[model samples]
Target: MPGLQTQSIHAGRSIDPSTGAVVPPLHTSTTFERDPDGEFSRRYAYIRAATPNRDSLEACITALEGGDETISFGSGMAASFGVFQALAPKDHVLLHRDVYYGVRELMEGFFAKWGLNHTLVDMRDIDEVRRASRPETKLFWVETPTNPLIEVVDIRAVAEAARAACALLVCENTFATPVLQRPFELGADIVVHSLTKYLGGHSDAMGGSVTLKNKPELVAQIRDFQHTGGAILSPFDCWLILRGVETLVPRVRLHCENARLIAEFLSTHKGVSKVRYPGLVNDPGHAVAKTQMKDFGGMLSFEIRGGRAEAFAFTAALKTIARATSLGGTHSLIEHRASIEGKTTRAPESLLRLSVGLEDANDLIHDLDQALGSII
Candidate 1:
């Protein structure tokens, strides 16, 4: 097998046979020509069903995640929806207590009306996971280094509990991209990602994917939902994601490095009440993260010493890091997660989630230090 960096650059890419172009040509045509015998010999019938660019993106993601097959979607939530749609109505799901807010809304607000049920549990505690498993539990959704809180879950341990319950373990790998953590290797049945964030490193594209370990039946169901639901990722976005995959390895390495430095600095800062990062030896999730991950990821969060007022004041004072909603780009972004999550928010009022970017580590720390000084 090629090294990860090599795979990132070469996997799912080939010299264009027709144009001999080094870069894959963008196939924008919505429909393909049929053979003289009235057969769609090219294997693509419609844009929604299949496309050259989308196929290429899925292929690359499958290789990166070491999964048997991958299905692409218009957005990360759509990919997650596709998984739930595979289950029958009245089926139960176990969700991490601190999963991305959108996922929680999708289940509790939207899917609940369709007879789909869910239980929110702290996935870091295996006992909680085991206790929450119902007889009808069909899926266990886990997001490690969980959104906002940066709480890590032991994927292997959760996988065991899911297995005992005969449920599929679906891991959200958006935070720890395959460059750092391969969930399939850690016993995940399915791995999903929001390409809008890290995989589309520029934040220029929006897409998502579901990669299955070896479940052909589930793959067929997801593909059916993708085609019938009409929420497939566009060819242009697929091409952009493919372009991002080429640089994933190096970009993620730098993200990890910068986050480590920033987390270390925040831990000792007087203005920070607590720092949530698995890279810290004292972090509750540090040991588990070290066992399963290549390195702690770029995302971290910290509670300000005072309150929400201080957190907002600190964010307003940052000159370099942008006060933004999304993450995983060339520029650093910080958000008061509680505000974004609204009334049901589990994030602390004083907490700020930071998405470390590909920037000078010292400069980012310096920016943070000055901001703290201003707020304190």
Candidate 2:
């Protein structure tokens, strides 16, 4: 097997046979021409069903995740919804309580309307996972280094419980990219990613993927959903994501490095009441994170000494860091979780999630210092 760095650049890549172009050509044609015998000559039949760009992107992501195959979707939420839509009407899904807010909305609104039931549990607690399992539980959904809070769940422990319950285990690997964690190696059956984040790196492309480890049955089902649903990624976006992934290894390394420095700086700041970052030795998730992840990842959150008003003020005072909703971009972003999540928020009123980016460590520290000083 090639090293991750090598695979990131070379996997699923080839020179153009006719043009001798080093980069893969973008295939934007929605439909392909048929042969004289009424059969398609190319590997692709139509854009929605298949395309060179989408195929190349899928192959790269599949290799990165150490999975057998992958299915691409228009957005991360669409990819997640595809899985939920595949389940039987009454099938149960066990999800991490601190998942991305969009997932919460999907389950509570759309999936609920479809008659699928869900149980939200602290996935880091294997005992709680075991206790929550029901005979009808068909899927175990996990999001490690969970959104906003960065709670690192033990993937191996959760996979064990999922196996015992005869359920399919799926790990959302958006935060801890394949560079840091490979859930399939830890015994997960499926790995999901919001390619709009780390894999895209630039936040210029919007995409999602579901990679299957040795499970042919689920793969076929999800593949069918992607094909017939028509929510697949565009060829241009696929090409952009492919470009982003080529530099994934180096970019993620810098993201982790910058985040570690930022986390440490925030921990000692007088205005920060508590910091929730797996990189911090005292963090509740640190021990488990160290065991399963190669790096603690780039996302983290902290609570202000005061409440929502103080958190908002601190964000407003920041000069270098931007106040934004999304993560995994070159620019740093800060968000007030309570305000965004509203009534269903599990985050603290004083909590702010920081998507630490590829910025100078000293500059990031100075910006945070100024922001905190203003609020304090």
Report, for every candidate in turn, its global Cα lDDT versus the true structure. Answer: 0.94, 0.92
Which candidate has the top score in lDDT?
1
Q: What is the TM-score of each candidate against the true structure?
A: 0.99, 0.98
Candidate 1, residues 315-357, lDDT tens digits: the string is: 9999999999888887999999999999989998999999999
Instruction: Give lDDT: candidate 2, residue 190.
Output: 89
Candidate 1 Cα outliers beyond 4 Å, as residue runs: none
lDDT of 2 by residue, 1-376 (tens): 9999888888888998989999889888999888888888777778888999998899999999999999999999989987888899889999999988889889999999889999999998888999999999999999988998889888999999999999999999999999999999999998999999999999789999999988888888989999988879999999999999999999999999999999999999889999999999999999999999999888999999999899989999999999998899888989998899989989999999999899898999999999899988
Model 2 per-residue lDDT at 18: 88
TM-score of 1: 0.99
- Candidate 2 residue pairs in backbone clash: none
> Candidate 2: lDDT over CA atoms?
0.92
User: Which regions of candidate 2 are displaced past 4 Å?
Assistant: none
Indicate the worst ten consecutive residues by lDDT in candidate 2.
38-47
